[model samples]
Target: MVAVGYTLMCEQAGPKQLVDYAVRAEDAGFGLAVVSDHYYPWLESQGHSPYAWSLLGAVAQATSRIDLMTMVTCPTRRYHPAVVAQKAATMGLLSDGRFTLGLGSGENLNEHVVGAWPHVQERHEMLEEALQIIRPLLDGETLTYSGDHFEVPEAYLWDRPERPVPIALAASGPSSVDLAGEYADALINTEPDPHVIDLFDSAGGAGKPRYGQVAICYGPDEEQCRKIAHEQFRWFGLGWKVNADLPGPESFDSASSFVREEDVADSIPCGPDLEAHVAAFKRFVDAGFTHVAVVQVGDETQPRFLDWARDEFLPRLRQL
Candidate 1:
């Protein structure tokens, strides 16, 4: 069976609401849950960005059965890898081995705020070095490294879990995929592309789990859902190259000024139609993704969407 997880969009909800929804998700039958780790929301209209680690601690305490993970966190900048390692270890212990650390080479919006904006290749190299620093530290070894991007002087996680927390690396292109294959316990991608799966498999990741995320908006009214999706998630269609380089919400606003509601309606499944939502998920399953994270856009429809998923969507999805 494909593992279906719910996305706790920190950008769109506050800490209490996120914990409430995660507890609801466990009660509603989602086997796993993932939260976005962002310092800022993609757009100002979406409006909230709580410290994800704190909220995750609350979710871990509130829910017992569901697995939890960050959809993606960048350890190269803003945070040193050693800090991430210590945090991930503590989260793993808090969640009783149910936590997975999802990582990626970050976007300019988050990483650039630290005052150093590296190019894509440099970012990838930084991520590789971060992984090297993280893996050994999580394994409870004292590590010292002087790499091109970062340096650690006799660093080790004192409060680490007995086992290393699994790492899932996000990949948007060939280089990232290659890195995932070489260093990660799993692979994550936003798109349903078989070529990516093939590339990962051929590059030493054949048996590793692949996770994919799909954005959708479900409401009683199709038009309203389309509007909400367009308003909040239209930045997703900008392509990774553009999405990774853009500095802030205003830059995204300027870039996506021409994006239409119909364009969002075309890409994301909107409305209460069960088949449309199922088809969106099936694309990822068909592309060989073992785990799928469904991001339901908009805060107002969250309760309804979770109810619908538990009662309608999940049963059909399991059958698929």
Candidate 2:
């Protein structure tokens, strides 16, 4: 059976509320909790962006049984891979070996703050080098290196869990799929694309964990859910290349201004219909995802959704 999880969207709520939600998710019986590492919200109306690592420390202390991870963090720019390795190692210790580090090539929205965003190919190269540095360090080896994209001067993590934190890579295409298979311990993708999984499996990820995320807005009425999803998640309908290039919430808002409610609702499983939500998750599971994270788009219906998930959603998904 696929391990179901909840998303603690740092871009949607403040740290305190997220910590509270993390506890609630654990209480509601979610086995895993994934948090996004973002410096800005996709849309200004989405509102918050707290430092994900600091909030993660609090979440680790607040919950005991739930597995914790960054849905994805970009180590190529704002954070050096060495620093990310340290943070992941520390998080693994804090979570008592329950933390997985999810990484990616990253979007310009967050990375541009440190420097000019590199082109896609350079970004991939940087990520590849980052993985080389991070993977060994997490395994308790001191690393000192000179690479085209990064330089590490003999860094090591003193505080680490007994087991190495699993490194999960976010991949959406052939290149990234191969990178994940070559270097990462697991796979994460937002879409239910089986081709991505097939590539990863053949490229060395055969027995690894595969994670998928489903975006939805659950509410009392379908109309409300559609409105909420459009307001908060319309930017997601923008293709990855477009999503990765935008510099900030304003840029996203402008680019997504033309996105219709129907467009957003078409892709995301909105409303209170349990079957719609189940089918959305089923797509990923059928595509071979071993872990699925449900991203509840808006905050207004969190309590209701959590209640529904505990009583209705989870039991049905487990039956699959």
Candidate 3:
């Protein structure tokens, strides 16, 4: 059967506060936690970006039996795969081996900070290279790698967990999905596009786990939430240049062509009645996403969602 999880903002909620919520979610029967990994706050208004790996450690200590995953982490840039491998190994050991490393091609918005910019095509190659480099190192031995994108000399992981950690790549495109099926343990495609399932299976991911996530605002009113979700969260749907990594001079053109300032405004579903919130999730379920994540995006009514998730959402979802 398919499963359910949530995407959390560590910077917004703080590690302990977020972990405390996940503990309650686990108790209430949620299956996993997909924490965001960001170096800088995506929006100036949101105002936070705690180091994700440290937060994952707290999450591991807080919940037993519930999977703790980065909704996705970008290893090709800001951090080297070798270091990510080391940290993931430690997190796995700390969590008693319940961790799954989520990978992605990454956004220019985040990865470019490290000075290596990636075009979509290059990012595809980077993801492949990153996985190749990181997986072997996670084997708990001294490793050596020299690739087109990265190099490591006799770099070995110390304190790795006894078992090999699973790797899941978050991807939506055909080539990237195929790469995951060919190399990774699972898939996380956050957009509620069920057609992505066919794309994945076409690439040999038929039996592998697939995950999706969506944003929602829950309250008595629907229009109010849409306004909040759209304006505050609009940064997400902006075009390739602004999001995908592109080389110098070209990225500005790509970002400018496909995305406009209004599109960057928040427009995700928020502050709606329990019925509408369930309806929003149903789209993912109908689209064939086996694991769906509901991310709480704003600060104004985030707490009321605890009551909404427990009293309103979970109980109602069980019947469906």
Best by lDDT: 2
Candidate 2 regions with alpha-carbon error over 4 angstroms: none
| Candidate 3 local lDDT, 43-64, one digit each (tens) | 5556567788888898898889
Clashes of 2: 0
Query: Using alpha carbons, what is the TM-score of model 1?
Result: 0.98
Candidate 2's displacement at residue 203, Å, is: 0.4
The CA lDDT at 80 in model 1 is 91
Q: List, residue by residue over 187-262, the lDDT tens digit for candidate 2.
A: 9999999999999999999999999999888877999899999999999989899999999999999999999999
Can you give the TM-score per candidate against the true fold?
A: 0.98, 0.99, 0.87
lDDT of 1 by residue, 1-320 (tens): 99999999999999999999999899889999999998888888889899999999999999899999998999988899999999999999999999999999888887888887898778888999999999888888999999998989789788867878999999967888898999899999999999999999987899899999999898889999999998898898999889888899888888888999999899999998989999999999999999999999998789999998889989999998
RMSD of 1: 0.9
How many angstroms is residue 186 displaced in model 3 relative to the true structure, after the best TM-score fit?
Answer: 0.6
Ranking by lDDT: 2, 1, 3
lDDT, candidate 2, equals 0.93
Candidate 1: where is the Cα deviation over 4 Å?
none
